[model samples]
Target: MPSLRMFGRDWKVAVDDLAVYAGVAGLWHVVWVIVEIVFLARATAESDQPCIDSEIHLFTWYMSVDIVCFLLYALLLFYTLRGSILDVGARKPAIYILYGISAIYTFLLVINIAASVLKNQFVAPCQDAHRERLALAIFICHWIFWGVWALAALLAFDPFATTSVEQRYAARLWLLKCCSAGASEARPGAAEHIGEICDRAYSTQDEKMESSTPMSQIGALMTLVFTGVDMTTTDYATALILVRNAQRMDREDALAAGVGKPEVAPIPLDMLEDAAHYLPHALSIYGWASNVLNKQDIAAWGCGASCVAPCTGKDVHVGDNMLFSSKNMTIQGVKVMTKSNPETDLLYMSWDNEIQGLLPYYICIDRPRREVIISVRGSLSAADWMTDLLVLPVEVDANFLGCDPSSMVAPEDVKIETTASRRRLISAHKGMLGCAKTIAADLRRHKVLDAVLKSDQHAREALKHDIYKQDCSDHQLVVVGHSLGAGVAALLALHLRSVYPGTRCWAYAPPGGLMSPELSAAMRDYCTSVVCGRDLVPRLSLSNMEILARQMIECSARCKQPKVRVILHPGKKWKRDDLFKPEAEMSADARKTLEAYMRNSGSSHCAGGKVIEARDFLTPGKLLYYEANDSDIADALVFTPQFVDNKEFAKNGMLISTFAVDMHMPWMYQMAVDKALDDAHRGLPSTRVEVAKLEGTCYAPEAAAQTTQQAETDIEAAGGRPS
Candidate 1:
């Protein structure tokens, strides 16, 4: 109850203060509002006096509304604060100001009310001089207090002071523009940031050495007024120091004006060695790993004209001396480190920073007619296994007919003894350059009949046919391969073209076959190659195959009709052997033809005329290898076997060779239509009444004999020893 009484007393005091504040503020505002409102309303009336009358009434009504609003506002404040006595710290200052204004206005209102009453009373009495004088004094004090309160409110929301130096400068510029035109034409609140606007303008002028302008003078004056206050603030002080330092630097440059032309040095090959000094960081290892094909020592790997050009000449295949400098040398940015078991020493290469998942790493650069030879005869570490059991091939029965099928399978426990071996035989052994030798030999031995016979045998056959038909007058040849395949293909194309100048192979994805860049370059124009993306299996050299190939095609003198493309086949479907499937089963007639073809082909699998691998498609006694090409044109040939079911197998493991055998049902049915088509196309012309005329056709043996005889004759004509 005592607490209630104390609250009640405070409430009364607040009420008294609010009443006084309202009365003083309302006095002039009421009159002003009434006059304005009366004039505005009366402007539409019949008489001109209505304007004056309307203005006066409107002023009175507006001021009275304000007084009522204030009284209500005071009550609202009391309600808002009653729940929290000491927690309104942020609101306390505003509350106090409001209380003071309210109290003064309420007092003025009381006096005004008293004057009305006294005026009515004293007018009749005419002798109340003391009361009349006291009324005048109260009126004068009311206006004075009103003026002071207005000024205080303006100060509380001081618009000149921005919280930070950056903002202050921004605001100051905004103000200066408004002040220049006296603010009537200025935007709203433009006057608020006058100080900020002036500061920026002056600062800008100072930066440009136009500090002597009139605007700068005004800016200096404004700064003087606010300097002391802002200097005390840490942020503004730091900003000022920074600006001053910038000014000093600008001045120092002005003092040392030198002869004007910018300096640049002449670049030559000699400077390349200086650039290579810092090759350690740029390369995967310390010493330069020369590309065996080209014999050029690449300073670094990957592209970046800016990073590499300073030390090494802009060309990627430069001497390591140029890349050794710290300026140009950098790690090959192309390498992507995969997040795997860190304890393990395996890092997979990705096109970018990280390999996506469990996909195999395959790097392919497709180029033709020019070559990028890498010589990675550096410190290569050899990794060997503990036992041969892990490395040996495992065999399982083709059929599940064994009595104890699981027991028949051998466990991986058998071991073979082996010794570690290393030999540095690279000094004289021809590397990928041997590929050229192989190609040359093949060309020398191959006849036109052989070319036609072997042509279009596989996808590579299609590529060879295209090469033969190509307009090689401008650009002769391109050789392409992936992994070790690329190296062989490149070498073959280059060597073949070097002697004959009639072939090209667009080689891609080459292994680092043992050949120097110089040797490869010497013979590569006859064959070009490209490497599309990063495949670390082929050691990354300073000069990338793709880039070098492209450069040669674009810039080299002897590289005729250059056609090298470094293409990235991310998920290309390479195998296309599903050519034998069809809608209906193999008919009785078609099955017979297929059987004959499989049994009588009798082609050797290698250069030595040895039997083909058991698992080769043509071989009958083994499972399908189901792998891509692995040998030369004839050697790498694939012949599909006749499909048969388990029941068709005889006790001796040979197929029964009967159409009605249940084991032959699936294949017979699956390939019926294709087999029929094959028969129709392959049928003998003598058997047909009318047929397409075949040209340049002959038996393999007859053609080989003719080719051998012709070659001997050519040798004899040239006065060489004939076989």
Candidate 2:
């Protein structure tokens, strides 16, 4: 038995000590149960009831079970202490029985607390209400006492032997079981290195030291004191087992020399310039879409009628920039569409429209750039997240795009022998597809696309700008958005391409599960997607989530030991406060798990059915992955923007980094683009190594010049340019 001396007092804990603690807890429970019973009996007698009904009797039964389980646990611990169960093998059954009783007692206590709270909340106004309040307090006290006892027992008994040599044996047995189960056999050379890998799985500073870190000790203390033992010893045991299993999986790939790197192309200088130019507008529109400021301010800023009241002066300046400062560009009206009222088109003139299902978009004309730009806002509300998750694949058709289904070629031989060569594409994510349809319908209903194409009198009236007076038909149509809006923008561009040829899309951090590979590949001619470092949104797809789930399950299944122990014998120094020191690394496990997941994800497979292949769902268009370069420059870090292959983009899994979510922010993308441009001007190498250059007319400056020249020639041929 282990013993410790604290505050000049000997503290010795054994099975008998645990038994005595259980007995004390059982007596405390009996006292509360008796008080509750007496109070209930008095209330029933006052109500003129013959006896307690089944509903009221439930409390009685629950209290009885709690008392019985605690007493039974105490009895079993005493028997073990007395050596009645001398053999270790035989004693195992008694220990399991004790754990089982504890589990039941913990469960009943939870139920009792919940019932007491409910009773207190719904109790009718009566003289006996105070009695119910008293009972609730008693239940809470019982819970707190049990939590403290459980924590003390955990420290005293060391039931799971986590610090002893038994843990190493347990880790080894787990690895062996996994190997025997064929996990090790799946990868070559894993079996030969099993011993070395198992050693690493359980290796620590000292075998006899407690595995609990100072931070974990603080967390445990907070959980015990504030949350009242929400997680039991069994829960902690299960967590430890899962962690050990993941370590084993990580170690299995430890010996691999290198991971295959995907080939990457440097982002074209012209494209990088375009992305940087439009990023501000893309970010600013989110503020407009949120409808948080004064309507006058929104209208003054060229974004239609604000949906809500004015915010404070401080809120208005938050992320506010000179969105409409460019003299060459004219601000057109914004179109705010929602599913609730599809019939009503909310614009600069409309007011007080419910913001539900709101998808706000605005169109602008840039004379210098010769472009008609439509910008959509990203997710900023609960409704938007709901849209993001609605990723069921829907087949692409004219009806799906808000067009007459009858017009799109009689639904005949949709399949062809040259499947890869077929021009027609299949499906898209339902959420983004719906958003696209909404935007398309609104554009058509208001003749917005016509306005961009012709720039005639109606165009001027529709856009509320005189810039339409200039034959703006020559200007290229560009669609831009960030995050959820990015996905919607991509889909909208695809649908609008046929009506307005040369339509281009700039999508920043679009959803990873937006469209089929065929559509994604086909869109490369027009759409350009920008992904910042470790942005989880672009990698979060249903397939990837399923893969992550499977990995967790596989890791859990590989472990055999589901118990953990705590060491209370402070090895040398008696510094009681040492248990609460801050940890040096908080997210190390998360980082490791993310790394292992990404490494093994390529080999994992999803269930096959009528469902679309996980490989088929990918981010649309030409992908530009923007990442920071590890340079020797002391002043500032250089960011390199590369056009990576679609396969590389598809292989990206959701990041579990501490900064993963932060990386997805619009400012992060903007900053990276800005840095890349700055680096380009400074004559620094944009990319470390480049494999190939992408040939495309989308981002090429010459393409815009040629289109402008062609429009001029056509106008002259038709008998002179428009006045």
Candidate 3:
């Protein structure tokens, strides 16, 4: 149980460490063999005799070096796996010997590379000349391999004496495998030895977490990135460690407070129908705004032929009643909203202006529905995708929401039950919040709301059309978007709610980590989030991603070594389906680990100390999950859209579902909504009939009646008449 030290610091060495060393050395030996063969061929071709003594001596020396290194690496691997070299007294010496061998091999390779380059450029050239070039090429490749091997050794052994929590965890996992191997050999005290190492490693990491600041950790991550580590992998590992530590802290806090799981109720049929009604409106805007709708399609909607492109066959048709022509929509009132002219004053006015900018959105008046719709397009440009990846929560300030400074109140003065408001700080997704603020400011600066109201008044006073005759105040302000746009739409709705009390948001496939749970809950009355099947976006968050990483690591630990492929024939084509099965079965241990992790980390808790809160960032507002029913008969496929009482609907964040990405498509949501409506009209029984009955609900005639009544009530509350 003694701490194994290298130089002045402690080291955690394991037999599994031999794997990296052996693999690198094996590759170098293979390259050395190829170089020697080329040299031998050149020597034989130049001489009339079979061989020259000097050339033969040089080739023999090269082969000898390669064979000796190969044998040494194989011997070390054999002893390490056998638990002979893992003895506490011998492990340090064994590692040192391995390092010595690598150094000697690298020194010899460098000499050979220099000699070959000199001969190729300045020395007497061979008769064929091609063999000399081949030797030079192999020498260069060998030097590259040597550089990689040296870097691997440095990182694997921590030669610089700097270690991180991620490195410690990786070392511990490696030791765990070594211990398993030792136990199979019945090596005495192996389990206890590994356990002690793990305990020390965990305590060291905990101490580091307690003392370190987020800024320092971020700086260290940057340093690692510059030092040859993959930036994405390093970032993910750092985030995962931080989240896991935070989760542990949160669990302790929850246990101390005696808190338990909260109760979750079933969703009502009326809410499902309400979300369905706006589904088409939310989806159709993307097509029109992105220029997927052709000139003919826009002209068919009674708008002039301003569009240039021919029909692309991707035009979104949402019935003749729904109008989304460029003439009807304006971006900052500076330009008619079109794909070719989407630029606005607020386009490059955000923090992310360096990387493109906020996606352009349009405001249009829906005369038939008496609604002023602000439709934000989903992630299309690089800026939009960048916005999606900026999941870090930033404090929501008055300026960020385009709020009037005079109207702002202190946290203590506000009587809201939400924690964010009470604490005087609201946080939202950094990128999405920025986009929301820019959009809000542009709307206010352009006086777009006033323009809409004036247009309504003008229509009523002059045109006197029945649809346009509705009172200006009666026009509902609705914000609709999909994917990244959906998140921004949710935040925009919250900001505008104070000024425009009747503002509503229809967020389709919005990110799961858009806002704090309390902030999300507060917006339920005004916002509706539509999720289809097992869409990944609505389930993606820091906590969920950490859980996924843990599951993957556990699965990797249980995975057996893959069978080596032996290709005996050339030009043999493999069947694509046979090579890559779509429906691969997961190992039993992996499945169990996945289930256990999900069950354990499905609750919210306050994470104190230096750790960021492991709190779940919930989807804003009432969540309507459209679970697709699997049926062999495509004609008999049923839709099951229902309101979810808790975020559990998106809790299983595993990316195992084949439809995870497909489900996030706007068309998928539209199709689901359409089918749900058809089922409601037909009074078809729900797929979850038993659960619906248990909840005293039926998706038949009675449910349809309730939906109608609820829609009327909602319309009356909004100061408008039902259609």
Candidate 4:
């Protein structure tokens, strides 16, 4: 017989162990049952009511017998069963049955004691069944015996990797927790080789030395190392068609004077026809989907991947219609298994959790097309992260960069430096530059300071590896983000354009001044930005906000509060408020701390690459209040008031707040392609297409489409169709 030891080389999961434990528990219950029967009968004979109520007495007998037989059956099965416990399919079901039987028996036992007391209530006191305390203990003992049997059965089966789903979720969960707790303790080169660490965490039986890394020290670097991919995935051809000949914002000071273009770039015809005119409806996916983020208000871990739950368009509202969720949203042909991280969107925004670092965003692979979509969630519903992003420097520090290649720190040194230098460096630096050090320290730990400074990470390398493992072809990555996520996507695209393959970015309603002239020129060939007409988001200049920040800083200094103030929103003029406003007000000390960062970081915020403008897509269905009188109702205006001057927009609807926010909706920005196309085809002169300027040899579908359109017009004039 095998030794009954629980550990040290000889510990094996065996059916014999189950047999031994169950047999002991069954024997205990059987003996208890025999004692209970004798006590019950003897007590009944001594009672003034010679027979206890037959129904209650019979129930007691049945329950005792059923329990003893149930244990006996379990013992027999364990002794007779063969092969590995992991191979057994009925184990989990059987264990659940045992648990249910125990619960029912316990409930009935309580009733048996209650019924015995009631029947003897009218009888003499000397022979009361309730007074027989010693006899009741035996029944109580048997009830506990059944509980023991259930527990034994539980350990006998494997719950991690079941027959139906082979994934060991518990192992993965533990791995995520451990790695998140202390990612730096992991060995050198661990960032590039996370699969090996995962294997160690998954296998409890492996005695290998490599698997010895404690669960809490799982490769946490994986969270920081892969950072994110760089691409927006919007078409450049359509962007060119919309903004080619459209007026450009030449005056940098125009935004400062509260001047904006209400009749901004319109969607082009080619893209409108691309989606079969369902472009506006399709665009709501971002706005509506973003609204689905379940922020939990937890610090650092505020937003998680929990919002990843499948979205159906049933609940979303868009112009008395619903988005075609079932039709257009199957990025994958069918639902694929994803790691379930069930938490609120707020908790996912956590920057603090080690187990779940940065919410562990997904790289969703479309199996058919072999395309990988890296989804980065936008700001949480609450303004916490938006505020943090403000305090947190927008650009990486220049001092932390350019470590000499020849004098590079060793991989082991990086792990050491992350732990030691992080706190010291943060303390040494003050304000935004200091805060920037803390961020730099995190990057230093993962040895990706250079990568993150450039918004480029090992995302492509890891993505390619995942594809190879899945036996999929190597292709380009498509990145899509909204609001804050759009800015991140653009930053990612700028650095990866020359380095990575198939680099395309589709920034939807991205913020203004985020683009620098160099980056704008660099990404022009491939990056396409879609902006809703008069949507204040893309029109919001960083210059105005910077001026506000400086004023707040100096105001604090004058008030003997040396503390500077930090607030990021349009300065009262063109003031618009809505969800994801990214507005905030902070102390002067905070303001001064981030002052250098504000000065050096993105000074301008405008659409990069080719800009596609959607005209009044977000404008309300019909004006709530119209300008024309009832006498001339036909031309009463079909949309909201188009205020060209920024100050004019602010005056109406409690200042242009309505006009500024009205067009920024994701559903509105979604139709830029269609609106531009409609505008081009609206009338004779409107039929003119904008021709784009090119610096490199790039294909222009607009040029070809125009040539064809002009030829067809000539044919139509001659009474002939050019088809």
Off by over 4 Å in 2: 1-265, 288-358, 398-425, 459-471, 559-610, 613-615, 628-638, 686-723
TM-score of each: 0.16, 0.49, 0.55, 0.30
What are the lDDT figures for the candidates, one per model? 0.27, 0.50, 0.50, 0.32
Candidate 3: Cα lDDT at 240: 31
| Regions of model 3 farther than 4 Å from truth | 1-51, 68-105, 117-359, 379-431, 454-474, 542-617, 629-639, 650-658, 665-671, 674-723
Report the backbone clash tally of model 4.
Answer: 51
Of 1 and 3, the candidate ahead on TM-score is: 3
How many steric clashes between backbone atoms does each model show? Answer: 103, 0, 0, 51
**Against the true structure, candidate 3 has what lDDT?**
0.50
On lDDT, the stronger of 1 and 3 is: 3
lDDT of 1 at 498: 33
Q: Candidate 4: what lDDT? A: 0.32
Clash pairs (backbone) in predicted model 2: none
**Where does candidate 3 have its weakest 10-residue lDDT segment?**
562-571
List RMSD in Å for every model shown.
39.4, 19.1, 13.8, 25.1
